[model samples]
Target: MTQTLDITDRTRLRRSHERGHFDRETINAILDAQPMCSVGYVIDMKPYVTPTLQWREGNHVYWHGSSASRALRNSRDAEVCLTVSILDGFVMARSGMHHSVNSRSVMLFGRAFKVEDPAEKHAKLARFVNGLFPGRYEGLREEHAQDLKATTLLGMEIAEGSAKIRTGPPKDEEADYELPIWAGVIPVTTTVGTPEPDPRNLPGVEMPEHIRKFRL
Candidate 1:
């Protein structure tokens, strides 16, 4: 069963109500599928949107950057909107008005906070690397104290958000459907390619299971 989420005032869908999904499962699926997101916030009433990679742990989403990053610095303790999106295909319609792209997207509102504790931040950092490749973090070089100190991690609770999705063929007006036009979905997909080994890798190092089977 698809569970529904209680829509807060900020998450309420205004236009395409039917396409709005507040369910946690649906929203998380979209987030997990995409590794990057854009965070929108304000600095002295000036708006800014930044592109950064994000990861999900349980119900919270986190992102990290250099300690000196202005975007990350201003984002801490600030009300922000985070969004993730995937382009599935292009929908060609008989008319330009109905032409659109099939996509899945999520918008979240929250006040982001910096992960202050070193131990907590370190654990989250490990999770960040492990989330993409299962055991790669343990096999890589150890993080130094200075390295940890130079990076800052920020997290936001997934308490309020909404997912809007569009799929399938384009919807055209009844009259426009009979026109001599070709309309269909030109599918788009993201796939992992063959692994390219580094020339400096140690002799006879075997590719791990995680890397061999990664998708998206």
Candidate 2:
């Protein structure tokens, strides 16, 4: 069955209908492609949103923050929205109101819970580190007991969600297409830069191939 969820709005968001995606494959791709997400929740009757790095394991998404983080503390046991988005290009149209962006975005609505098991929490932390940089955990020093105590990890299962995407050229009005106006997509991309060694580091410690050859 193709699961469907209500989009918050429809009119102002022109492509609300066409832009929304319900497939698991599409949703997972958007989630795995990016490492950052904005978690939204209410704290003390006020809305709060915080940006942080996240990773997925099976159906659950994992995020970590300091134990003292206000956003993390308030999110436990609450309904939350986690969103990951990437802007791929700019849609230049003949009219200002028609201008839009080409993007891949996923919004997940679910309940957040604090991970309580020490062993499981440590394992999840390892996975989170590995997701950011493959083979990094092996090269780095092992986590100390205090490090675990200072961090709080939370997991949320994506109960209901949607992926919205917009790509290709602008959809200007038929009459406006005849107007002498430049119309096209300005493609955007993210690229990795060469690794620079720290000033205090030992001489001739060559950059690892993984760092030199990485691409986002």
Candidate 3:
């Protein structure tokens, strides 16, 4: 894959162009750091966006949903936009207009394709689970054929996208910096909390290392 993504009208940043990045390294890093994403697609000339979990492997990104989902059905072989964002901090400036967010976000545009082969779909699902919680899939019950049939996996190559990131203190006007009001960043982070075990878990079934060590 090329080191940088091709810049097209759709991928160009019209505002705050300084924050735009086209390198694959920056794009992949942001995608891997966040699993939750929103997918935008059109149906019958109406637009819709669905929130879902995403996983990346090599130069491709994948997301899954119910086979009966209207979004997944219409997204197949259709142009779609996938976006992932991570909020790092809230920028507080002297003026309300200067207040902003410190964040990293990526927007990708492509034609989504369905994973038609059952075996390939199954493997991809396992990879998705194992990617988040290593070795956890092996301890769980095997997936039923019906379960796999009810799930739909869609993927797109990471060929047309750009990442926008903002960090550090807010940018305020030179005159505003002298104002008496304090200005700084309030850091934000996503943290994993303690895991709660199922009430019905069998006796002597201990929490696996993968679960204990899992991080987002």
Candidate 4:
């Protein structure tokens, strides 16, 4: 496989191009770090973007939703844009125009395809669940056929994409740097909190080790 993705007009960076990266390592890192993503597609010539959880396996990324969903329906075999972003901090600059965010983001352009085979879909779904929660999926009840039927899984190869990242302190003009106004970064992070178990859990049932130690 190529070490970097080819930059086409669609994936080319128009501004602040230094922040853009076409290397697979950087792109895959950002994708693995951020599971939340937005998929943009067009329906009836009107654009639509849907927020969903994504998982990457090798050179492809996958997402799922209700089988009857319009977003999933329209996305199948259609060209789409999938993006993932992680805000690292708030950069407070002396001037409003200079204020910005420290973040890592990736934009991918590709044709989305539905996973039509039942066995493959089930395995992929299990991988998704297990990827997030280790062995949790193996302990869960078997999935019903109807449940599988109600779900839709879509995937796209990571063939065309770029990772754009911004980090560190703010960049202010020479004059603005001398101003008395306070300016600095407010770090932001996503943390997993204490797990809240259902009150109706079977008597004497304890929390799973994975639940207590989960991190994202």
Per-residue lDDT tens digits for candidate 4, residues 1-216, read 112232435626333233445366788998999899999999989999999999999989999999999999999999999999899889899999989888888888899999989999999999999888899889999999988999999999987777777887888999898899999999899999999999999999899988998888
Residue 99 in model 3: lDDT: 92
How do all the candidates rank in terms of lDDT, highest first?
4, 3, 1, 2
Tens digits of per-residue lDDT for model 3 on 1-216? 112232435626333233445367788999999999999999989989999999999989999999999989999999999999899989999999989888888888889999989999988998999999997778789999999999999999887777777888878989999889999999999999999999999999998988899899
lDDT of 2 by residue, 22-68 (tens): 34567788889998899999977888999998899987898999999
Per-residue lDDT, model 2, residue 84, is 93
Candidate lDDT scores, in order, read: 0.85, 0.81, 0.86, 0.87
Which has the greatest TM-score? 3
Task: Give candidate 4 misplaced runs (Cα > 4 Å).
Answer: 1-22
User: Per-residue lDDT for 118-190 in model 1, tens only?
Assistant: 9999899899888898888898888899888999899998777777678888889999989999998898988
Off by more than 4 A, model 3: 1-22
Please provide TM-scores, in order, for all candidate models, with all chains considered together.
0.89, 0.88, 0.91, 0.90
- Residue 62 lDDT (model 2): 85
Pairs of residues clashing in candidate 4 = none
* Clashes found in each candidate (C-alpha, N, C closer than 3 A): 0, 0, 0, 0
